[model samples]
Target: MTRLAMMLSAVALLSGCAGRGGDLPLQPASALGRERATPVDATYQLGVGDQIALAVYGEPDLTRTYAINPNGTIEVPLAGTIKAQGMTIDAVSALIRDRLADGYLRNPSVTGSIVTYRPFYILGEVNKPGQYPYQTGMTLEGAVALAGGYTYRAQKNHVFIRPETGGGETKVEATPEMAVRPGDTIRFAERFF
Candidate 1:
């Protein structure tokens, strides 16, 4: 009876170990696809290391491309420094217009666009994992392609991503159309088999 009880206890422990208790929850591939399908606040927020082109109508001197400084501000001639971080393109344009309207221009018609996006990082289980230039509408598959595709032992089903906006790392099933955002860190998981 004692031996049978010990065997049952060992079996129970083994069963508990077999259960996925510590693994990160992974979002289904279709879930990511559905997320991509839904249009949520599609505005792109500016951040440090992003290059922006600002144009002021009828004012050639004030129209130029500017890089967001490390301090998250951009210095405009005559208008001084304006905060651009975490602001949308239109918001930044409006702010610049307001600043220039303050004795700088009669009616500052300003428009802004992103010239270049910040780079994204990829690591683990890829052939060449490192920072790569971010392009608009880039997908995770494209990012993997940029990283020279996955390694032989890479887990092709899912990957972990840490967004640039700051959040806990998410485990998401790998899909071809998953969007990749600027400054995101993507980590490919290795296969256990």
Candidate 2:
């Protein structure tokens, strides 16, 4: 009876341990995704490879698109070259208006918008991960899908993104609604089950 009791107790202990500790807790990097805060949308910063469209009121000749030069400037007719990198659309419009007002046109009304954004990068644990063209209202989930979806062992809920505007990488829980910006690098880590 004592031997049977001992065997039953051993089996109970083993089963309890198995139920309690199936996998080791994820390390700091992996654990980071769970405690996500609401992500704020930062203003879009212009960079090289971005295509911008600008138009001036009643100036058909000046209404066109131009790719940002490697030096962060764009050529404008009669206005010469104007710096555009790191400036918002409104700021660019103001700059153009000021430039055109000089010996060109009085109170030149200008409007500018981004035609194309720089490509985003994705690597690690995703199938066919690489650079992909960025679209408006992109999210982490969307980026993963563009990269051909997650791999078999991808941590679908955990992701890290590095912004091109200069901040370091951030780890956040993957959500379909979180907005992604151009020139961001996304990483879908592997999961250990």
Candidate 3:
């Protein structure tokens, strides 16, 4: 019985050393600044590849949908090129309004909203790991599902997420309800039996 107890204690110690189901190297969320923090607010900031539906009140000519260019700018009629990436919907609308007010219209009521969010990336230990279009209220488990679910060798307990806005990667305990933001990169580690 004493020998069995010692073996069990060793196993417990080893498991603790391996971390909560073998966590990989990743930065903590606390290390990120507010500018690079994950989006938990109501409005998601725009990014490249995001489709935006913009409207100009009473100006059908200016109402249309635009995909944010890779360089983070959009081409608006009369406004020429306006930067939209990293900006919220209201900010982009105001920009359009101001540009139209610049001798184009008496008062332009511009409104904009995200038609589709940019894609998120998933890598490591998955059946199909690659970039997938982001959906609202997506979670880490859903992302894994999009990537064809976890492989038999997947760790399955935690994941590493790197924010696209230039913050350090963070390792988080994996759960189906954990919210995922756009432009995030997820990496699933391999399980060690």
What TM-score should be assigned to candidate 2?
Answer: 0.74
Model 3, 1-193: lDDT tens per residue? 9999999999998876674545445443333332132444546688898899999999898899999999999999998898998888889999989989999999889988788888999999999999998887777777888999889999887778788888766776676667677888888877776
lDDT value, residue 132 of candidate 1: 97
Candidate lDDT (C-alpha), each? 0.84, 0.77, 0.81
Q: Order the candidates by lDDT, highest first — what do you get? A: 1, 3, 2
Name the runs in model 3 displaced over 4 angstroms.
1-43
Selected candidate, larger TM-score, 1 vs 2: 1
- Top-scoring candidate (TM-score): 1
* Number of clashing pairs per prediction, in order: 0, 0, 1
Model 1: runs farther than 4 Å from truth?
A: 1-22, 29-42
lDDT of 1 by residue, 80-126 (tens): 89899999989999988998899978987999888888899999999
lDDT winner, 1 or 2: 1
Off by over 4 Å in 2: 1-42
Model 3 residue 30 distance off true place after TM-score fit, in angstroms: 9.5
Error of model 2, residue 160, in angstroms: 1.3
